[model samples]
Target: MAGAAIKKKIGLFFGSFNPVHVGHMIIANYMATQTDLDQVWLVVSPQNPLKPKNSLARDYDRLHLVRLAIGENPNLRASDIEFSLPKPSYTIDTLTYLKEKYPDHQFVLIMGGDNLASLHRWKNYELLLRDHEIFVYRRPGYDIPQHFEEHPQVHFFEAPLMHISASYIRQAIQEGHSVQYLVTEPVFQYLESSALYKS
Candidate 1:
């Protein structure tokens, strides 16, 4: 009875949404409604260490795109916590800061199965496994690696697969091809109006 009263559960999804798209929303919505998490926050990273800087869109622009994409979803939110942090954003450090800032919230990391395959390369990934739970969504051609099961905190969700990528979106925009349905209409408008990722 002592533990039955706690209701705050948070899902933390970290990514550089160079441009927020429908695929990202599908996974986030799936995790929020289908899982134990009460809310899902899209933590828009200012930078990602594993990806090349040249390919990344402006941090604030990406954040605004995320906000536009998630509009009016009470359970979904856009966060710019990484914008104030150091470059080459590290998830472990962000997680640590988040935990301290919101002590009552139980946070779970939401990621794609693709990340599970390369999680070991992340900085302090071992600590990530130790300190937080993971909710993994599937990706094409990327199976959840065996070692993830070695950690008791990891959980897999057979999330709906949406074959979309920011890279693809960027390429489409640069080619003057329509990416109309790949992302939300608002997002598409923002990208077109702002002339983002068109290079």
Candidate 2:
């Protein structure tokens, strides 16, 4: 007789994570603890189709920062899956690959309300909604659309509002402002020592 199967529910949070900050950490923590997800994986994109490549930091550096911010969290993980995929990574492709690779686990897409507002603009977004479940976190200004709000596959979760953004942190670093509380200690130290985001 075969052994009983072990399956897990994982939330995939896809981002460039130019420099992982406290806001990102808080959201991931909330998702892992407050929701049904067994684990949350931060999928670091090598190149986001919606973002310009020049505006991003090195892929490995961004991945490292994500690792630092998620330190010692048993339920949180950092994945560089998109790094090995083709450039200008698309969410649909990543999701498909993840589903194929981990057939035993159920994969859910995690995104901000802001992203949800523009989700229709993404490549093969219809297929995404048709095949997978998505967890949308409310952003400060953006609200999920009426139709999507009622979608069976979409679940909205309320997280503590955070105005912090990676671009803001980078700008502060460039202007020589203290980022003491903005990022995790390890990430802060790495940014400072590596002189990252200082133009």
By lDDT, the best candidate is: 2
Per-residue alpha-carbon lDDT of candidate 1 for residues 1-199, written as tens digits (9 for 90 to 100) = 3665584899999888878889899989999999999999999987789888888888888888999999899999999988887888899999888888888888899998889899999999999998889998877798777777666899988889787889988998999999898999999887778778877
Q: Where does candidate 2 stray beyond 4 Å?
A: 1-6
Weakest ten-residue segment in model 1 by summed lDDT: 1-10
**What is the lDDT, from 0 to 100, of the residue 1 in candidate 2?**
100
**Judged by lDDT against the true structure, how good is candidate 2?**
0.90
lDDT of candidates 1 onward, in order: 0.88, 0.90
Candidate 1, superposed: residue stretches over 4 Å from native: 1-7
lDDT of 2 by residue, 57-169 (tens): 98899999999898899999999999888777988898888888999998999999999999999999999999889999988778678999899999999887578888999
What's the TM-score of every candidate structure? 0.93, 0.95
What is the Cα root-mean-square deviation between model 1 and the actual structure?
Answer: 1.8
Which clashing pairs does model 1 show? Answer: none
